[model samples]
Target: MKGKNALEMCARAEYGEMRGKNAFEMCAEAGYGEMKGKNALEMCAGAGYGEMKGKNAFEMCAGAGYGGMRGKNAFEMCARAE
Candidate 1:
């Protein structure tokens, strides 16, 4: 049981990392990669928008599915292909 929980946590961390990396790549493609201060790529790559004190780019892209849903991560939204 302890191993299962550990694996689950590891999987969640990996998932978040993948999501952040993908978000950064997508932002780069869309020309939102760079900025004068903190770049969008960094923002997406590291903590994402949620950790920046609000919702992440992926969650915002989710539209209606994430409407009014507070305290939920981007993983809850089915906007991106998994």
Candidate 2:
């Protein structure tokens, strides 16, 4: 997705007010943001997934590197990472 789509997802994922999602879930779906998880964070950051969302550190790394999580390009790349 484009930067605008990432920004929109970030707006919808505001802390504590997420619509049907937790931080990890929202961050993963937004395609950018920071969460916790060393392996995942590094990979996501390297891929520039969260950069568009203004995330200082990449979040949802675990999701992007694993299955059972949602992200666009990152999700597709999970296969190789895993």
lDDT of 1 by residue, 1-82 (tens): 1223222332333443333334334334343334223433344444334434343444443432334534334444322223
Model 2: residues with Cα > 4 Å off, grouped in runs: 1-4, 17-63, 68-71, 74-82
| lDDT of the candidates, in the order given | 0.37, 0.40
**How many backbone clashes does every candidate have?**
0, 4
Clashing pairs in 1: none
Give candidate 2's TM-score. Answer: 0.23
Tens digits of per-residue lDDT for model 2 on 1-82? 1233333444444465445553345545543334333233343454445433323333443344345434534333332332
For model 2, which pairs clash?
A: 32-50, 33-59, 35-59, 40-61
Model 2: number of backbone collisions: 4
Ten-residue stretch with the least lDDT total in model 2 = 73-82
Whose TM-score is greatest here?
Answer: 1
